[model samples]
Target: MPHVTATKAMPVPASKAWEFVSNWGGTDKWIPGVGPVVVEGSGIGSLRSADLAPETGFPGRISERLETFDLHKMSFSYCVVGDNPIPITNYLARMSVKAISKDSCEVTWESTWDTELDEAELVVAFNGLYNLALDNVEQLMLSENQ
Candidate 1:
């Protein structure tokens, strides 16, 4: 299994960050290139499908299922269930937010997946994707505060 991790510190409280990221269905609000996400059910076991914008060059839909959700811990884990846009298998990702200070927090997003492609190649691609998403999160949070 190959893994990729992207971490970023955002100028937002942990509670505020959790309130947004843990929503699961609200990914489009912060995840760049992702369109509206449609979700079924609520909390753990919820299923979600989101489409990638055509301009992002990865135009397609991907579906995922929430596997673990922890509110107090400000973390969640999910598995890709169908229409995987990425070239990987047995994909599982965990995202968590940790309080850094009274007004800031760190978010870590990590994923492990099996792929036939060269590990180095996949890592670079996944790293870019995850980092872009994390960057968007910071931008969104800051903009909201302004």
Candidate 2:
């Protein structure tokens, strides 16, 4: 199994960040080139699907299932379900936010998956995606506060 973790600092409180992150269906707001997400249920066990925007270079849809959610803890875990464009299987990932100060927080995304393909390449791709999404989150949150 290959594991990858990406973390970024945000100029917002953990609670503020969690408020945005907890909206599982609102991922498109912070994922650079993802279209609106369609959710099939509410809370844990629900499924969300979205198509990557053409400009993203990954022109395909992805479905993910919410595995665990904790509002108070500011954390959640999800797994890729159904068909995946990435050549990986058993993809499970978690996202969490931790307070760094009264006005700042750190966001971390980590995942482990099995793949027969080039692990290094996939790791780099996943890390890039995570960092990009986190960067988007920071920008959106900062703009919202300003």
Clashes of each: 0, 0
Cα lDDT of model 2 by residue, 36-124, tens digit: 89999988999999998777666789899999998878899999999976678999999999999999999998999999989998898
Q: Tell me the whole-model lDDT of each prediction, alpha carbons only.
A: 0.88, 0.90
lDDT of 2: 0.90
- Cα lDDT of model 1 by residue, 44-91, tens digit: 888999998877666889899999988888899999997676677899
Per-prediction TM-score to the true structure, in the order listed: 0.92, 0.94
Q: List the residue pairs that clash in candidate 2.
A: none
The TM-score of predicted model 1 comes to: 0.92
Best by TM-score: 2
- Candidate 2: residue 32 Cα off by (Å): 2.4
